[model samples]
Target: MILTFCNQKGGVGKSTTLYHLARAAVASGRRVLVVDADPQGNTTEALTVDVPSDAAGVADALSDASTDTLRDVLVEGVWDGLTVAPTVGEALNAVRDEIANSHRPGWESRLRRQLEGLKDEYDLVLIDSGPALDTLSTNAFTASDGVLIVTQSTKWSLDGLALLLRTVDEVRRYYNPTLEVAGIVLNQHEALTSGGKHYAGELEAAASENSLRLLTPYIPKRAPIKDAVDFSRGLDEGDYKARPLGKLYSALLEQIMEGTGR
Candidate 1:
């Protein structure tokens, strides 16, 4: 199964969620490949600590000048069963701009083309896209079997979800007809706060209106989740406080797998 975790809004925990999800999948004994398509490289940095600055990555695979394939850029991840195709530096920004400016037909399908034949090598491929609906994100949507929308319980986040859904529809109509939105993931949710409660209600209404499933046991706002990522440790291998949060991610992964029939 291939899934992309994305949102048009930054700081919505897309990278963080994808990181933990990869870790949880690894713990479940599944071979996981994490494709760090985001130019910011947060997922790359977190999953492959101390990756060489000059390493070939997703940017190289997408560039017209390079002969690199996605398979050629694979790097070992922090965990045993996790592999990564990293976005190491500013190269991805250049590639994104190149794709945007080029008149080449099928520019949006470059990543999809690069990802061909990878399904047999890994049980799951999870892509972490940048916080935009640009060519990079379109490529991600084009390549993915499903997209897992990540958002926080906030007014602005809810507003961005509408635009994201529209983009999904456009991609489905044009690129990958089998593409589906696996579900919505509510991250960094502060359940006890009034603002959280208000937006949570709004998010639920929006999901219902769109016939989208909101994955249960929304991730709560917690220091340990961030700490685990920051420290380059899997939630299950971090401080004891982080183990419970790891279980939540495990449950969320199960929900995603069941929803997508993986």
Candidate 2:
């Protein structure tokens, strides 16, 4: 299954969540592939330290029609069972205007066709998307089997969700008809405060009204999570099960797998 972590608004932990969840999935003896679809290359940089300037990444794959050639750009053994098709810099973004303004039919499904050739090698594939409804993000939606919406529990984020859901619906009708909403995951949750609780109530109501499943064990703001990113290490490195973020991520992984059947 291809699960894309997406939210048009940034700083909602799409990269961070993919990083932790990829680690958790690998620990469970699953062969996982991470597609860094974002132009910012946060997930690529975090995993590969520095993407080489001349390296062939997702840009080469998307720019060509040769379906089976994407594997040439795959970076293997990044972290045990995880392999990455990294997107660095703005090479892929350079074609955004042409893609948006052109009258080409079926250009939107390029990434999906390319990924379809590679889905059998891994048990799961996760994509980290940029904070925009651009060509790259639309390609990710076209390729993905399901989308996992990541957002903070706030009024502004609720508005963002509505906009993103509209885009998702468009992709479903025009691009990938089998696309499903895996779930909504609340990040940086702090339910102790009154504002947090109020937003939590709002999220619960929104999910119910929309007939969407809200995944449990919301991720909290924690130091270890930041440290893991800073030090470029997995959260489950050393006695991490004792850490709050570690336990929360494990539960979140379980919730995701259960909901998505991956």
- Candidate No. with top TM-score: 1
Q: Write the per-residue lDDT of candidate 2 for residues 72-145, one digit (tens) a residue.
A: 78886357898899877786676555567666887898788788789999988999889999898898999998
Error of 2 at 19 (Å): 0.6
Superposed by TM-score, candidate 1 places the C-alpha of residue 93 at a distance from the truth, in angstroms, of: 0.5
Model 2 ranges off by over 4 Å: 64-68, 239-242
| Candidate 2 collision pairs | none
Task: Assess the local accuracy of residue 125 in candidate 2 as a C-alpha lDDT between 0 and 100.
Answer: 93
How does each model score on lDDT?
0.93, 0.83
Q: Summarize candidate 1's per-residue lDDT along 140-211 as a digit string, tens digits.
A: 999999999999999989888888999999999999999999999999999999999999999999999999
Model 2 residue 203 distance off true place after TM-score fit, in angstroms: 0.8
Per-candidate RMSD, Å? 0.8, 2.0
In model 1, the clashing pairs are: none
